[model samples]
Target: MLLKELVDTAATVAATRSRLTKVEALADLLRRLPADEIAPAVGFLVGRARQGRVGVGWRQLSSVMGEPADAPTLTVADLDALLDRLLTTAGSGSAALRSTALRDLTSRATADEQDFVGRVLIGEMRTGALEGVLLDAVARAADAPGDAVRRAAMLTGDLGETARLALVDGPDAVAAVGLQVGRPVLPMLASTAADPASALEVTGEASVEWKLDGARIQVHRRGDDVHVYTRSLADITHRVPEVVDVVRSLAVDDVILDGETLSLDEDGAPRPFQDTMSRFGADAPRETLLRPWFFDVLHVDGRDLLDEPLSARLAELERVAAEHRIPGEVTADPAVAERVSREALAAGHEGIVVKGVDAPYAAGRRGKSWVKVKPVHTYDLVVLACEWGSGRRQGWLSNLHLGALDPQGEYGEPGGYVMVGKTFKGLTDELLRWQTEHFQSIETRRTAHVVHVEPTTVVEIALDGVQRSSRYPGGIALRFARVKGYRDDKRPQDADTVGALRALLPGA
Candidate 1:
């Protein structure tokens, strides 16, 4: 199939707000795809490369200043082969080779095709047809049950392959995809709750466990071979040998354990999340080592626990990783939930997760089966700038750039503020209007996407916690930050400080 056809369909998908339209367009595109092209087609539509992060960065892409062809000539297979060469091109003159390859590819593409290619290469499709919508499209095209398709994709952690199997081999083949010992499946996620009592009220008889502020580790063991994957399913087995050794110590011949890993202080308390990420993201040697704390087991000794209830999974977890199991209790009592939450916080952890005892793990989806409770921290932070919103809020200053005062010059100049993050959450149309008008009055400078304003406006922001940041000057950034409301009465200097945020760091 032509790359232009796919790019045109992506534009149509993005132009419509109706999911039904997106699904229909995608399904039509899928029906036209030959079996050999299914994976790359699906990958491109979903804004990912089948080759995966082919050593291309925005800087390299920015260098490809080519005049796009007025006509379409690139094929889907053509782009795929180009990506293959880009990924494999390396050695001394590799930089020049990459530049040449990118230039040639872009020069052959039309303007729209160039935009599509850029978006796919940068990993931001923005077509409104993400994995969820694309999964529906695959199911529609294959005439298969959505659950079967979703389960196959979830278990294999490869939506593109799932699409190929569902289209080429039929429903049974997709259904045949199951939990394997070494291949990482997508980790089940939790929804947020106001408190432990609220969380327990939703889950009933539950397994409440510490929600550590650490990297998620999915440890899979088959015989002596063990692999560790992150929450996003990236294998990081070589980064932490200690975890591999611990899983290898397990007597079970084959198993998959879901847990968190972080480096703790000498007192056995969890260190700041930055310290954990520093070690997790590093490829170099470090003195600090991460320790794993298992909370659930998906497989044990070849028996699949994925379809089993949480109670059963916990039992298997206890049998396999009892010593490393996170501190928790099984109860329906709110008092017990509250106590466990307090205990977790007292232990220098972030929060607690309450799991329904009878609920099976719903891989890759955030269902009501699991709920996480954490104290919300809100601060009157200054708005450094605002970005032009997209979609419904287009032309409005929607995303607020947030900053924290650094009075002591700990992060930057004395008496100035350091940027922590940006968020457009919790904004109503009324708020957007107010910000658009208000920010323009104090606008100091402007860019195509951002309106820089004098840091005089104070807005209240809420977040889950903070993480260590190399991008921000303060060496920290807010996690899950959202705007609460504008604090009209507060001055910029009266806003929260970097020190105040650092105090929220675990074990601080």
Candidate 2:
């Protein structure tokens, strides 16, 4: 298929707010894709290239700008091959060589194709074709069940592969996809509530577990071999030997466990989140040991428990990994839920997560079946832009322009962020210095006083609440907002949404 067709469809999807229209447009495009181009086309439409990162940055991309081609001739396969070359390019003068290749590719693309390729390279699709919407489109194009497509996508952790199976191989092939022990599946996510009582109200007869402020890890063990993955499903087995050792010690021969890991001080208190992430991001195991705590079991022996209730999974978790189970209790009483929340806070943990006892694991989906409760209002927001500091803090990036996700384009572009507010508070001098350097590396454009960057960096922000305001496009502004820290573990899509912030309005 021609690149222009895909780009045109993406433009149509991004130009509207109606999800059904976006899905129909995408489905029509998907129906026309040949078997060979399905994967790359899906990846491009979703804004995530199959070749993860090709070592291309804003500086490299900017240096290779050129005039565009007049007519469309590039094919999807041609673009895929170009990405392959960029991914494999390396060594002493590889940077210059890669730039030459990028220039050649861009010189052949039209204006619209150039814009689409640039956005895809920078990891900003901004097309309303989010994974959910695209999954529905795939189902529509294949005339398959939506649930089957969703389940296959969740189990395989690859939307491109799922699309191929649904559109080419048939619905039977898509439904045949199941949980594999070694392959990492998409982890289930949670919604938020004000407190444990409120969370319990949503999830009756719940398991209220400690919500630790640590890095999320998924451990898969078969025999003595174990692989650890981050929340984004990047393999980090070699960096966390301690976690591997813990998983290896389990009695079961094969298991899949979902949990958190963090370094602890001498008194058994969890260390600062940054300290833990620093170790977690290292290529090799550091001196600081990270301890793993298992909360839910997805697979044990040869049976997959993802379709089972939480109560059944907990029983299996207790039986196999009892020593490493996170602290929690199964209760329906609100007072007990509150007690667990208090205990978690006292232990220097975040708060509690109330999970419905009867709900099956809904992988890769965030719903009310599991609700997180924290005493303070904290949200993960994207850094849209940063302002140049002044006075004593001159020459540094101080004020941060924060944005919340708008998945449905209710306020603006679909799958884009809505600016909520700005903040210069809670940033130490060290943080300011770091951001000034970091933001420049990813800078997209700049003004005299502000440096606009790619909307990828995620920072946790604490706020009193939100109030109705005409100052921002989202119809609400943050109150008393301050940075808690940068969340290196999360992606821009994982940030809280504008609707989530609006939910904090008075009498909402």
RMSD of each: 12.3, 1.1
Question: How well does model 2 score by local distance difference test?
Answer: 0.91
Model 2 CA deviation exceeding 4 Å by range: none
Give model 2's clash tally. Answer: 0
- Model 1 misplacement above 4 A: 377-508
Clashing pairs in 2: none
lDDT, model 1, position 250: 86
- Lowest lDDT sum, 10 consecutive residues, model 2, at 278-287
lDDT at 214, model 1: 77
Q: For model 1, what is the error of residue 52's alpha carbon versus the real structure, in angstroms, after optimal superposition?
A: 1.9
Per-residue lDDT tens digits for candidate 1, residues 306-354, read 9999999998888888999999999999999999999999998877999
Give all candidates' CA lDDT scores. Answer: 0.84, 0.91
TM-score of each: 0.78, 0.98
